[model samples]
Target: MKFLYRILFDLNKEIEEEAIKEGIVYVLNYYKNEFILYIQAYMAEARWLNNNYQPTLEEYIRVSTISSGYCLITATCYIGMGNIATEDIFKWLTNKPKVIDVAIVLCRLMDDIVSNEFEQKRDHVSSFLECYMRQYNVSREGAVQEGRKRIVDAWKDINKESLMPTDVPRPFLTHIINLSRFMDVVYKDKDNFTHSEGEMKAFIKALLLDPMKI
Candidate 1:
């Protein structure tokens, strides 16, 4: 198990560097393959969980495999972004050193969304992706605009009351607010983007090896 973990870690680091030099196309493809593998493993675990009997060794292996996939995906994102501290994040991603910190926070939020139990809630992956996209802004008629404001406003109010005034930037706070709204749509939607076997293979190829068009 340790050997496998080490191998995955090393492979992830190499892929992360390549993806960074490439582009979002490569990153997206890489994540898609990882996501598919994890989902398959998760399905096995879900079946085990639904059975009347206790989990067997095989079931445990399935769960662990799923978890390893998740860990690799998370590591890839962190490594690709250069894994700077929250305070120094802005500097790493920007010339003026201001965007990195906010990007870090956004990455954390994205991680949370991915780790969330959306499958249990009967939510779909496309919905979650849409929610992540909306983290940048809010719309008036969308799902998030309906009731997400309350949760976001309350969180902001609580933070304001508890933290020092200088601890949080207004722009960052605003980003969180928008992110909250986007997540609402994700949590509520059920439709997922469907891909054929060929499409999936193509996505993997684009992500893992095609540096020219990453």
Candidate 2:
């Protein structure tokens, strides 16, 4: 525990020094708070696992979306983003506004759909499928069907959110949507991230090697 505490201390000290040098100290607490929420989310999942406790879909989503780390990732994206990443933008993100929440929720459900079987083979915590199935008393396929339906609904919500006029800037919304798209690509029909030898390799090659046509 002492070693762990020292490592955490060193990480914070490093981030604080960098943030100060970059004149972005205003985002430091936001980053730290997001990390705290991320850690607490994992701890909640662990406790549920240890106690053999099953959460309802709503309860599971509440924690799982934080565990998705989208908020933390977004905060990290803003750390050195210069003038555009105002403190107000960070505050907006921290409040868990509707659009970003839908994005991460889409990410979480898509991941669970593609990864639940492999996760279940281990001593992992119950995934979204498990929670939904348990709550609704549905079969595995039924749960999957329902999960996909929710994902489609989330995408519809995201589309509506994007099309409507809003106070938030477009870049931030686009960035969050990009993160969701990444999750969708990596975990759509399979765990493409883990089994990266095939399509993922091609994706990288296309992204890096093959130049775009003009």
Candidate 3:
């Protein structure tokens, strides 16, 4: 954790160097607040676990979406985006824009869907599946089936948001969309990220060795 803190602290210099506009420097302060919120999201989940609290689906989504780290990654990605990421763009993202919101949701759901069982076995906090099943009085499979439906809907929302005309640059939106897509691929069939030695490694190796015919 200390190493992580040091890296985050060092990012101030890096971000300042990469940022050109004076307003971008001011926005860096705002991003620091985002960093705080990110940590708070994780702390909230820890508190829930410590108290043995079972969050409602709404409550779970509110926190887990932030805890998913997609928003933070989006912010960090934007901070270094040279000039396209202007002050207004940074402020807009800080407001939790719809495209980023849905991406965060998509990521959290996919992660929980694939990792819930393993986490449950380890006596971890209640995941979205458990919360939904408890509230809706459904079985695990039923909750998962519903969850899959939500995932499909999330993809639709992502596409709609990205494709529609907007003020934010297409490249910035691409970062959010691509992050969600990455989550889809990583957690679709299994938690390949956690077990990266298996499918993840093989996929990387193949990608590096194989050339695209197209």
Better of 1 and 3 by TM-score: 3
Question: Each candidate's TM vs. the true structure?
Answer: 0.26, 0.90, 0.90
What does each candidate score in C-alpha RMSD? 13.8, 2.5, 2.3
Inter-residue clash pairs, candidate 2 = none
Supply every candidate's count of residue pairs whose N, Cα or C atoms clash at under 3 angstroms.
5, 0, 0
Residue-by-residue lDDT tens digits, candidate 1, 1-214: 6998698677756775666565533343545455566667666645645663344433443344344343334434433553231323232222312222232233323333334444436532222224433553544234334334433554455355334453344544344345434333333232211222454456556668784652
RMSD (CA, Å), candidate 3 to true, equals: 2.3
Candidate 2 least-lDDT 10 residues: 75-84
Taking all chains together, the TM-score of candidate 1 against the true structure is 0.26
Error of 3 at 126 (Å): 1.0
Off by over 4 Å in 3: 11-13, 20-23, 207-214
Candidate with the larger TM-score of 1 and 2: 2
- C-alpha positional error of residue 50 in candidate 1 after TM-score superposition, expressed in Å: 8.0
Q: In candidate 3, where is summed lDDT lowest over 10 consecutive residues?
A: 18-27
Question: What TM-score does prediction 3 earn?
Answer: 0.90
- Which residue runs of candidate 1 sit more than 4 Å off their true CA positions? 1-13, 16-75, 83-182, 192-214
Q: Measured by C-alpha RMSD in angstroms, how accurate is candidate 2?
A: 2.5
Segments of candidate 2 deviating more than 4 angstroms: 1-15
What would the TM-score be for candidate 2 when compared with the true structure? 0.90
